[model samples]
Target: MKSSIVLGLGFGDEGKGVVTDWLCRQAQRPLVVRFSGGHQAGHTVVDGAGRSHVFSNFGAGTLAGAATFWSSYCTFHPVGVANEHRALVDLGLAPVLYVAGLAAVTTPYDLLYNRVLEANQRHGSCGLGFGATVARHAGPHKLHVMDLFDDFVLEQKLGSVAAYYRQLGVSFAEEVLEQQLEDFYRAVDYCRTAIHCTCGRAHFKNAADHYDSLIFEGSQGLLLDQEFGYFPHVTRAHVSSRNALEMIREYGLPEPQVFYVTRAYQTRHGNGPLTLEHLAPQLHPTPYETNVHNPWQGEQRRSLLDLNQLRYALSADAQYAAGLARQLVVTCLDQLDGPWWVSDDDRRTTLDTVSELAHRLGGHWQNCYGNYGQAGNLVAG
Candidate 1:
């Protein structure tokens, strides 16, 4: 049996859920594990029956009968997870899911802090409390889902967080703080009996001994990785295959094929570098629900893939491909109207206008995939 990881190569909303679901249908009873980020991620899965499910905290396989495990790096938003569970049930999907015993819990304090931080500055954050929660954990007191049952300890942790925020000139009314704490406690209590899990070891054991394959799904993109991505603007997780490889190595599992999914026409969510203006008119944006102020901005045009940027991402993947090997899967090929680039008598015009902008941004375009297919199967030029 092999364990694989499928990750995005862009700034996220890269259709990873669709890719994961596609891979799940090919493998037998695969165990899907999420290694990084949390409710800040948005994954939409359209099943074989043509029904679509939008997920935030839940895994892509919840509709496919595959069990999902949330690693310790992920944050647990009990209310969000519970609400997603109900939506799944309403759609006639099973709510059987698992979360690491020690996953960090996103409290109301974290949410409030996130709102305050975003309002005060411009980090292009999703305002999901991800960064704020991480900041809280890095402080003296660390609280996880397991700590929720211990009211005394939870209160202490909240107090410490409150005091820390207060010192920073951020104010929180005492009644509001108390109410949030109480709500957080209740949410944790509900999730503890429902989806909490300590299955990292056992889940891996089953995948290694029983299942034919396992797929690790990553959130965010290589460009948004905390280490390799654009500094200070990236997500606070390792959105690369390395995290998946580490998990498989810990479980002594066989190496699985790694697939890097990219779109024919590039797209990015939130505020970041994008070549959207040069894209085709048909690639216009569609309405999407997100925390971003201008969710409809990117939808107005298609984003062109910066060959140099793609090369950078590929180079990173190549480094991680040492053990399991890797391949590139380009999606949404139909979105591009012509060849990668169109040349005039004197100047060269890229099929994606964004590519041209990236060129002006001092990005070189030598390594663009000369030939590729809509289904992601590559053809040698």
Candidate 2:
């Protein structure tokens, strides 16, 4: 009844994908479950087939014959899920993914509201209706996948949402509204027959009873946790092991080892804290691509720096860390170049060479391993 939950300790894109894929490969097969967030997540898993799949809706275990279950906390984009299914099928993999019938759907209105709100006012959002959708469902006007089964209820909810948006001076074209509703209904139909999920509790209980291990995968990173994160700028979801542990407890599964996935260098997609200017000269340069179009245009890549920020994040989520994590997994060690530094130095750092910048920062290094092909090697302390 061993159950493990792998999560990002920092902001989103903390290499949880590689960690999840590695665990799946090690198990050869396991029940993988996604507990939080929604289609806004970008999980990149490079499979044993050497084909990489970026998961937005589906879990990473799809390639390795792991059955995936999305809990009610997660929000779904039917089109995104469908596209992912097609991608998996094209790769000769079974897209046998299931979602809780109670999982909320991200509608076009949600996307529109997200774009409009975050356009000029920068909230460091992914512009994927992640926050908007979550906020909408947090109150009296909640709508879930099950609600789509009732036409009157669904229409009433949509009308309410539309009226609320109109008060905000955001109007949708009638045709657009009609088409979105149609698409929503179509997706509900497709999901009901193909990918709808039930027995969420039974699935976990069975996995705990029948399997050697159960791995819970979390999206986003801890720094973005709504409760513990930088206020107003954080993600709406709780990106910590706490949520994972809660899910395990709810399912009556045995507590297993928790692994916190992090990268050697700090990387952030949207606008946020980064000691970019100082470290930029030494690190290998890359372009930052925006996942969506908005006022937060242009991609900015920065070099990893020794910031107190990581320590602060760790402290904030200490409770979750103290309870779940047995070890920390640092990824992308090979990708990093030049000396890891506390302060940016022009002389010792080089773009292609890897070196230690300072001894003080070097102490921050911990026990972790790296993945390369079939073998995973320990980074010598």
Candidate 2 lDDT at 156 equals 85
Clashing pairs in 1: 284-299, 285-299, 285-300
Poorly placed runs, candidate 1 (over 4 Å): 173-183, 275-302, 334-381
Clashes of 2: 1
What local lDDT score does residue 328 receive in model 2, on the 0 to 100 scale? 58
1-381: candidate 2 lDDT, tens digit per residue:
567787786677767777776677667457777888889888877665577778788877677777788888788887667677778889888776767778877877887788777786777887878788898877655667666667788788777766666766877677977797677667766665568567577566566445665778888887788887777678888777777777877878877676666656666667666554455534443222223334553364445543355555566556765554354566555544554443333233322212232122232333345543222432423
Q: What TM value does model 1 have?
A: 0.82
Each model's Cα RMSD = 5.5, 4.2
What candidate 2 gets wrong by more than 4 Å, as runs, is: 150-153, 167-169, 173-179, 284-297, 323-325, 342-367, 372-381
